[model samples]
Target: MKKFIGLMVIGLTALMVLSGCGDQKEQETSSGTKETLTVMASGVKNGTQGVFLEQFKQMVEKEYPELTVETTLLPDDQYLTALKSKLSTGQAPDLFLVQPKKASANSVEELAKAGYLEDLSDLENWDKIKDQGKNDMSFEGKPYALSSSISVLGTWYNKDLFKQHKIDLPTNWQAFLAACETLKQAGVTPIVMGDKDSFMIQFGMYQVAANQVYPSNPQFDDQLYTGETKLTDDVWVKTVTMYNELYKKGYVTDKSLGLGQPQAQQSFVDQEAAMIFDGDFSLTAIENDNFDLGFMAMPANEEGETYLSAATGAGYAISKKSQHKETLKAVFNKMTDGQSEMFTNWLATATSFTTYAEGDDLNPVFEEIVPAFEAGRSFYWSNQAWPSGTETEMQAKFSEMIGAGKLKPIDVTEAMQKKFEELTK
Candidate 1:
């Protein structure tokens, strides 16, 4: 009887082990194989692109349960270079952010032409994307990227400082200079700028360009592309000369050459300057200090009306070589939904006008430019029509002009034209 009981116990133990193995196999099958989706983007974690990525990751992981989403956020300069290297090495991330066609190095059209970006025409939300956004990200009639929002380039000012000085916001180029002079006399930095990030030059110049170049010759970009116009033309020269006035008058912060975007933004937030030329993307950083701030169009030609420099913000695209594109598409559909919290957080952080059908309510500072947008008195960023690396070249030339103090605006304009001509050839 004792021997029989021992055998029975051993049999029971084996059966229990087999049952446990069966249960483990069932669990593994139910959970499915895990896949990781990698995303790379430009901007800080608290910035628009970062917020969008985080929200998407959460929404996607929650919805898919078996997918892991990983992201890397880099500064604009580094991000473009890194993405290019990754693409060349055949190790591109599943999803990466890119600017619209003709905007930057990692632009949608450039990447699509290189056969790196995937065609997103079949996306469920493709029709829902605003026409402007679609057009910006499309190449050869195929959409490739998802624009987060639209932003305006303008002058952001400390409202309290203006109010204390009893200064009315300038509505014309002369008035703008006068306001800067007044601020200077009051011992205030008239404009905060970070020239180290030469692209910041565009923030100030595009507004002027919109007023100077686009209003009369709306076909300037088309003409330039077709070799009928040049950056050295009277309109471009006027734009550059007018924009250089701020630098010439010592209105820009002396430390601008050494300052980066973060430092410059901090200076503005700390009220070291009365105004800063920036885009709506910087609004979150400005507002965090709870300083009463206001925004205005760059008073280009003084029509006493705003002419905005507006464009669709940089967006995300899937790599054509990605193995997990279907998964990414699903995640993107959920994240880009106008009704989703993902988009809401993005809008709040970005403070830019949304391209969604149901847009977020505008903050009062942004409300000032709404009329321009409504009146369709806005011009897209001129860089959007420029060739790759041309903006960088312009920045370098302009920086040299500003730094060396002998290189005139004409020199910068001619150099830019040469670079543009070279790229076109």
Candidate 2:
């Protein structure tokens, strides 16, 4: 969170969808009269982000002088469910924002491939965006979305608090556990965690699996795609077993599994918990806590390393189904180039660093842990990077496994094995 209540408090839904379903089409909004470019983004439009976006819109109208745009904000834990509902009613917004998160990606891509999202492969400014940020929607060698920024996911903690607790920061798996155990005995909940939101598990899973898949080890994703390696390999077992042990140890708070993300974060902020395993979004984790915070990725295993996490947000996609393409492209261009800087500033204000470029300043949390951030092992998180539908079943099973107390480190890998066989077909 950088999302106050969930990742939702951040309120950048339409912004998130930029990559998954962008399309380019002919102009419809008259030079001044206006053809409305209705947009769908989740979250309230009254914050600093709204102001920045509004400013961008004003400038676009002044600069382009031919378009009028309208935006709608949708918020709910059932975000994807809402998008799906819109599709069935045949009322998808002219241009809606999406995230690489499961439902968002699945719906957006299907819509795009099926000619719902405008094929923006020819946008003039496409080259300006970063390649890594576009990983979600660069399908079949053609660009489908306008990805503007990138954010890295790592564990955030209060350094001053760590010192006060007299615990050394962890650098490896053993070290990680020692610190967690130390916190436990001290009446400090080792981790402020929540799986109420499915995406949360992805962070945990990535912490354990990214290094194994980093730089393209087809041993997992690729093999599953091609029906090569079995999912029930030793790798899966080791991964799941790690989680199983962690859960069995009472390291996590009991309320965590029951609490939604927002509450979980507030608990951490209140100091009910000592450490939180999360991403840059932690900026908003403790909305009430002005306390100094520190951040780094999941502590290392025996290798004392982790894969760098690249999560999704603020991607622009053209609706292939839209009758008006030019205006849409123009709107996106304005949104990405003119408005993005300001809009991202608000997001940065609301949370931490999400944009690819510089903002007002680095989140204080990032400042404290910069040394560890640059050092140690890092990898591209696998969950966000996986092809569509690759990990849905696995994630669901993982949650079930955790609640059932039937999981182990190896099960993480094994569950993938089971999931792969079902998914590939």
Candidate 3:
């Protein structure tokens, strides 16, 4: 009986030891906790948005050792579809990109209305974001996203090439044509066009329209939307005509319609062409070269004045249903704290100005046009007000017009007007 009692006591002691070990393991597991966050960003995997996310993830992991961040970077079209699908299914990422209000497919206003995005009105970072950016991403007067940057569209040229040919920078449309003619005479392509992507044509056309169309009638878009005016109006035709002049005068490349954006950009970089119409975003690929580059607002009118196409670019928004809001908020705070390394890294590669406080010195390429933005000599791209698919339709119709070469500019404008009417109807 004493031996049996001894065995019972030892068994009890062994059981206690096993139980204690189990508890220790549980405590360690609980103490070493981790949270994960996912983000859906637009652009190619190696593009700006992708690079931003990569840096952001490293910063977050370093700052919050218990957190892990993962991002799925996709091209624009795929990103839009994925973002909408996830939002509608209540599986949205913890953070996602939101384009300005009225932007096609991923409009912040629409997302906010659907209760899929958090209201960032109370975020302390609001003090850092530009007021125009806040207003651009707001819904019902409440901020819904954090604008990353502002992009401007203009004429980017090779300075050395211009100097070599003694081509003075033109300030008026006529002089711009003269410069192009001189460059052509020197056996240089005046403009490298990527009309294979119709949107490329709009890069220049819209800048022209900013000066030729909006200054005369700032409310023209509103009137056109209300059907009180038509694209057949004189201002629009002039804008279209001004845009086509580059092609009509043989200043653009001979195989412009066959060339893609990469090819055209490369042509300019290789000194095969003197100029190309593109946004500040092109600077990513441009900054690597040793060429002396300069940017100028498109010279479209007779007054020798230039106008820029400026607008708020993409921004970030927190998911209303995210389970990791605090973690995401912390990341955002660190990113915009101004003194953080994230800010510096972002400023270094950005093609445009950050909407958050003044970034590091503007890229030298924008030296000539920075004054235009500062002086309020810029206009928002007109398509910003249109509903989804309208601009895409216009781009397609414009491409067709380029091919037919028979449709008057007014006819092209009329087709755009008709599509707008039908789509909105």
lDDT of each: 0.75, 0.55, 0.71
In Å, residue 212's CA in model 2 sits off its true spot by 4.5
The digit string of per-residue lDDT tens for model 1 on 63-120 reads 5455577878787778878998999999999888777767777888889999999999
TM, every model: 0.87, 0.77, 0.87
Better of 1 and 3 by lDDT: 1
How well is each residue in 1-425 modelled by candidate 3, as lDDT tens digits? 00000000001111111111112221223658766768777765465665556766765555455567787877667777888889888899988777777766777777888899887766667778777777888999988876556777888898988999998989898899999999999999999978886668778878988898888778887787788777678887888888887888889887888997878888888888889998887776655465788888878878946888887776778899887665455545545567656445444444566676664377677888877777778887766766767677667766776777877688778877777788678
Name the TM-score of candidate 2.
0.77
Poorest lDDT segment (10 consecutive residues) of candidate 1 = 1-10
Predicted candidate 2 versus true structure: per-residue lDDT over 205-300, tens digit per residue: 666665444433534654656666555665555665665556678877765567776677777788788767676654543545456677776654
Q: Give stretches of model 3 more than 4 Å off.
A: 1-35, 288-290, 346-349, 357-360
Q: Sort by lDDT, best first.
A: 1, 3, 2
Q: What lDDT does candidate 3 reach at residue 277?
A: 90
Off by over 4 Å in 2: 1-34, 43-70, 75-78, 85-90, 100-109, 212-219, 287-290, 334-361, 368-377, 385-392, 407-415
For residue 394, give model 1's deviation from the true position in Å.
Answer: 1.5
Q: What is the alpha-carbon lDDT for the whole of candidate 2?
A: 0.55
Which candidate should be chosen as best, given lDDT against the real structure? Answer: 1
Global fold similarity of model 3 (TM-score): 0.87
Model 2: how far residue 376 lies from native, Å:
11
